[model samples]
Target chain A: DQQVKQNSPSLSVQEGRISILNCDYTNSMFDYFLWYKKYPAEGPTFLISISSIKDKNEDGRFTVFLNKSAKHLSLHIVPSQPGDSAVYFCAASEANAGNMLTFGGGTRLMVKP
Target chain B: AAGVIQSPRHLIKEKRETATLKCYPIPRHDTVYWYQQGPGQDPQFLISFYEKMQSDKGSIPDRFSAQQFSDYHSELNMSSLELGDSALYFCASSFGLQKGSSEKLFFGSGTQLSVL
Candidate 1:
């Protein structure tokens, strides 16, 4: 059972445009969500995260919005750049669950310059 | 400082053979995690070690085991490997397993294992 799901397998957008990736979760116990970006032959790097207490969090050009009632979350990258092309994974964990995370299948983002 | 480092960037083994992968977490980090990633799929959790003890284990088979030493280094061992075990293995670390905190993870380049 995949508690976290990223429905879109891939996405393409023009450079300098806003790129949105969506994720949904079924576990209500998950209180923290995170996004990671990975390039070919490399490990995933941390991008941004959001807490259940807050609805939105922004860091530089990346913004994460959460909707508790709908059990949904999204990551928005503004002014997408070619370097931003990679696989984005959404993960979640409960506070006392020993920080074990359940991850989505991941969405491949391609930015065309 | 260096991030997580995994040794043996690539390895090949035959069925029923044993393979070992090593990982050194970031200096001073207490949490180490192992994950397996297959082609066109996301990474799946295998196990985690904190402070030299097994913290959690995923639904992986018994053939897969992990150990952590005092210096915060970890090792993954696979006995009687099967073709299904062929994939990319990753190691990660965090300061602590706290929720709602930075909880940022530093990952290694990964070890590509091919079981023949």
Candidate 2:
């Protein structure tokens, strides 16, 4: 069973525009959520993360918003650059669940210059 | 500036053959985790190790085994491989889990294994 889901398979946006990627989870036990960016032939790289206690977290040009009641979260990249094109994956884990992450099918983001 | 290192970047094996994948964690990191990503599928957690001992288990098959060495490196051994075993295997490392922290992991480039 896929506890985490990303409904959109791919997205395209113009450079310098805002790119929004969404994710949802069914497991209420998960208290930690993370977003990773992966390039071809490479591993997923840590981008940003948010804890259950907080509703939002921001790092540089990336922002993550979480809605506990809706069991959903999203990642937003401002002024999207061509280098930002990659697969974005959403992952979650319970606080004491040994830090094993349950990942959602990634969303491919393409930024056109 | 060191990151997790995975060897052999690519490997090919036939059915029923054995394969060993290695991982070298970043300096001072004590935790290691393994994940597998198949074609058009999300990454699946395989197993994890902390301080050279098995810490957590996931959907790892019985045909596979893993262990962390004294040097803090880890290895995954797969025997009796099947066509379904073909996938991109990733190794990640962390400094250990701390409560109320980000608990982010540093991942390697990954080893792509193809079983024919």
Candidate 3:
């Protein structure tokens, strides 16, 4: 069973607009959530993360929101640019779970210029 | 900054054959992880090592095994390859084990393995 799920396979947004990607998880043990962006033929790069302790974390134009009660999380990019277009994966790990990450099926975002 | 490096970016094997994929973690990194991504699928954790010792494992087939060496590099060995074994294998790394922080995995470009 897929513990993490990114229901949206792809998303499209216009440049300078806000882009939001959503993810859900079934495992309640997961306490740490992360977002990674990947390009074709390249490895994923870490974008942002949020611990279960908080409801939100932001860095630059990237912001991650976590709702533990709903077992859902979302990544928001303000003023989205073409460079932000890529496959975004959401992952979760339990602090005591030895760092084994459970990944969601990625969401491919296209920011049209 | 140096990222995780994986060798033999691509490999092909026949059924029942064997293949070995390698990973070189960043300088000073002490943890290494292995993941497998099937076509149209998400990455699944296989195994991980911290300080050259097995720390965690998940969804790895019995035909597969992995180890971390003293230099902090890692290798995933797959035997008895089957057509289903074809996938993109990714290697990731972190600096060290601290406060149970296993997130923030820096991944390699991955090695695509094709089994015929």
Candidate 4:
């Protein structure tokens, strides 16, 4: 079963506009969530992460918001750039669970310049 | 500046053949994890090792086996491969075993295996 799910298969937005990607999880035991960006033929790179204790975390132009009650989280990229076009994956791991991350199906975001 | 390294970027094998995939974790990193991503699917955890010891297990098939060596590198051996075993296998590493801050994984480019 897929514990984490990214409902949107793909998204498109204009450059310099805001882009929002959403993810949902059914495993309450997961306490840490992270977002990764991957390019074609390359490994995924870590973008940002948030703890279950915090509702939001921001770094540079990327922000992650978490809603524990809704079992949902989102990543927002402000003034999206063309370089931001890639597949975004939402991953989660339970505290003390050997740090194995369970990942979502991923959402491909395309930024048109 | 070093990142995880996985050898044999691409491999083509026939059914019932055996293949071995290798991974070199980042310098000073003691934990290694393996994941498999099938077509149009999420990355699924397979197994993990810390300090040369098996720490966790996932949906790994019995036909497959893995081990970590003294240098902190890892290898996955697949025997009697099937066509369905074709997928992208990724190797990731972290500094700490279960540290909160080390939750962010540094992943390798992945090894694509095609079974004919």
Scored by TM-score, the top model is 4
What is candidate 4's CA lDDT for residue B107?
95
CA lDDT of each candidate? 0.91, 0.94, 0.93, 0.94
What DockQ would candidate 4 receive versus the native complex? Answer: 0.73
Cα displacement (Å) at residue A109, model 3: 0.4
**Native contacts conserved, per model:** 0.62, 0.60, 0.64, 0.71
In model 2, what are the clashing residue pairs, if there are any? none
Candidate 4, residue B94: how far the Cα is off, in Å = 1.4
Query: What are the per-residue Cα lDDT tens digits for candidate 1 across A1-113?
Result: 87899999999999999999999999999999999998988988889999999999999999999999999999999989999999999989876877677889999999999
Better of 1 and 3 by DockQ: 3
lDDT of 2 by residue, B54-111 (tens): 9989999999999999999999999999999999999999988664343468899999
Where is the poorest 10-residue window by lDDT in model 2 chain B? B95-104
Chain B TM-scores per candidate, in order, are 0.95, 0.96, 0.95, 0.96
lDDT of 2 by residue, A1-113 (tens): 89999999999999999999999999999999999999997889989999999999999999999999999999999989999999999999986886789999999999999
Q: How many backbone clashes does candidate 1 have?
A: 0
Docking class of 3: medium
lDDT string, candidate 3, B1-116, tens digits: 88899998999899999999999998998999999999999999999999999998899999999999999999999999999999999999998766436555789999999999
How far is A104's C-alpha from truth in model 3 (Å)?
0.2
Give the better candidate number (3 or 4) by lDDT: 4
Error of 2 at B54 (Å): 0.5
